[model samples]
Each structure stands twice: as structure tokens, then as C-alpha cells.
Target: MDPFKNWQDWRKNLDAFFGENFLSSFENILLYNYFPQVNVYKTDNELIVLANIPGLNDINNVDVFIDYQSLELRGNVNLKYKGFKLIQDELFNGHFERKINLPYPVKEDRIDATYQNGLLIIHLHRLIPDDHRRHKIEIKKIEE
Candidate 1:
């Protein structure tokens, strides 16, 4: 009885028990954390975000939120093909939420988001702090 032969037999048994898609399933599980993949771009005065989220019946189903330092997204991808057996399921179909940190602080009031062609585009302007808000304090020396 060779050790190499025993190892091969064990591998065969595992494959037979888990089926061919076991590897794919494992990959999906590992990659599930970053669903609806997004690309972020930063300019001198603006920050742009592009997200890929398809299979949405209504664009309103997605919610977008932003703050000075981050952007939050919550949505669902539903492909309405019910009453049929699914084979080779690969497309993402479920609820997903992702919070992305912005490169710079963005102005909350000046933000825009649009959805078109299965893509969500977000445009934001960088926040410039007001210089006039700073005030000088006077120091007094104590006399003994």
C-alpha cells in the first residue's frame, strides 16, 4: 500500500462527496464579502465612485448614503426567473451592502448619484474647510 495511492483515494472520495462545484462554492464564499464590485476615483476636488449592480427591477430598490468620510450602499439583485430549476448559477442575486471609504472628505450637500445600464455612478465634491472659523487666543502673563 503506497502513501501516494492512499492520498489519491482520499482526494477522489472528497471530490465525489462534494461534487464538482465545491471549489466554485468555496471561491464564492471567499469572494462574497465584496459584492457588487466598485471602482473609486479621486481628483483634486472631486471623488467619483462606480459600482456594478445588475438585475434590478426598480432602481429605487437601492439606497445610497454618504458622509464626510465614507459612502454606504444597500441594494438587492433579483432576477425574476421563478418556477424553473437553476443550473450553473453564477450571477449574484441577493441583498448586498458595501461601505467605501473616500480618499478625502466630501461635501455632503454636493453629491449626485445616477443609475444607468446596470451601473451606479456617484459624483461628490471635496469639502473645503472654512478658514475664517479659526480664532486667535490671547495669553496673559501672571505677575507675582
Candidate 2:
């Protein structure tokens, strides 16, 4: 091993490999990740999901959906800036979407949503079964 392989040389090589705007691009990717952070909770009769979504200007623009097996959230973060040059922006912008798998089937008609303080809360009611499947039949003797 050569003693000339110093920390500064390694850092320079890393910087060159990743390009001059590497850090900013990496930060942007992290900030605008595909999925928003969410928390899920379940009770005996319902399931609730809370998602963190800052920079949302209007609640009506967000869409929420739920089916028997999954839940989906989609929205856009509209940020309007004047003639000021953006030096470093780490906040997420544009359309954001997230889908979550539910542990049990849910009634789609009973779903509700509310947004407050940069968080969106969704409520889903569990589906109830109304049918019983086992029926007793008389056994017939097999003829040889």
C-alpha cells in the first residue's frame, strides 16, 4: 500500500465520481423520496393511517382511496417562488404518491379522511362477514 493514498485524495476521487452537484442531488432525492412517511394503527373495528405531508397548500387537491387489501394516497405539493434564485431546496415538490397494504379487508364505502397541521389522517372500517360455510350432509354407503 502506498502512503500517498491520503484522505484528501479519496475525497477528491469520490467528489469526481459523484459529480460537482452530487450532494445537492442526493439531498433532493432523499427529500423527494417516492413514498411519504406514514403510520398505521388498527383497532377491533377500524384501521387508521396517518401520513406526513408538509408544503401542501390545499386539502382538496389530495386524493385518498381504500379497497379490500390496500390504501393509496396521491397529491401534489405546489410551491410558487418569485424571481429569487434557489440556492438549496430540500423540500419535496410535485406529485407524491404512497400505497399501503392492509392486514385485513376493509369496507371501501366506510372510508374517511381529514387533513390538519401537515398530516393527513385516514379512517377505514373493517369488513364484517355475514355467511357461514359449513353444512352437514348425510353420508351415503358405497356400493361395491
Candidate 3:
């Protein structure tokens, strides 16, 4: 019983157990965990978010929710080829939900979203807090 032959047999058994495409399937699972990559940008008075989501048949089907300082996105990517078998699939397909925290609170009514060329762009205005309600306290020195 040669060590090299035994090692090769063990590896073959492991590969058979896991399947030949096990590694690719595992990578796809990990990659799709954060599907539709997003980028957030902050300006002086607004925030801009860009999301890469393709294969959207209808933009109206996607749901976008904005809270005071958080944004939620829910959508699905469908790419079906009729009468054709999938040889390789790198694109994400199915339902996905992602929540993002904003750097500052945003005004719910002042948001605008648009989808163009597979990119979802959102513009949100920053919510300004009222400064008039803030009160300053005076310090007094005391003698012991």
C-alpha cells in the first residue's frame, strides 16, 4: 500500500462525496449572500446610493423602504433561457433583501429613486434637526 496511491484514493472519495461542482456552488452561495452590490455616497446635504441589479423585468416590482437612518431593498433577478441548458451561471437570480444604515438621518419625503441600465440610483436629502430647542447651561464657580 503506497502512501501516494492511498492519498489519491482518499481525495477521489472526498471529491465524489462532495460532487465535482461543490466548490463553485459553495462560492456562489457566499457571493449571493450580499447580492446586488451597493455603494453609498454622502454629500453636504444629501446621500446617494447606487445598487447594481440586473435582469429586472419591471422596476415597479422592487420595493424600497426608507426609515430615519436606514434603507431597505427587496427585489428579484430572473434570467430564464427557454429551451437552453445553463452551462455556467455567475449572475445572481432569485429574491434578495438588504438593509443599509445611512450616515445621517434622511427625509422620507425628499427621496428620489431611478433605475437605468441595470443600476438603481437613490437620492435622499438629509434631515436637519431643530437647533432652536437646544439650551445652553452656565457654569458658576463656588468657594470652599
| Residue pairs whose backbone atoms clash in candidate 1 | none
Where does candidate 2 stray beyond 4 Å? 1-31, 133-144
Judged by whole-model lDDT over C-alpha atoms, candidate 3 comes out at 0.83
Compared with the true structure, what per-residue lDDT tens digits does model 1 show for residues 40-97?
8888999889999888779878999987788999988887587988887777888999
How well does each candidate superpose onto the true structure, as a TM-score? Answer: 0.72, 0.67, 0.71
Q: For each candidate, how many residue pairs have backbone atoms clashing (under 3 Å)?
A: 0, 0, 0
Candidate 2, residues 1-144: lDDT per residue as tens digits? 222226356546767998765555454454456446777899988998999888788987788877677988888887768987778766777888877888788997898888889999888899987778777999999999
| TM-score head-to-head 1 vs 2, winner | 1
Positional deviation of residue 130's Cα in model 1 after best superposition, in angstroms: 0.6
lDDT of 1 at 8: 49
Best by TM-score, which number?
1
Winner by lDDT: 3
Q: What is the C-alpha lDDT of each candidate?
A: 0.81, 0.77, 0.83
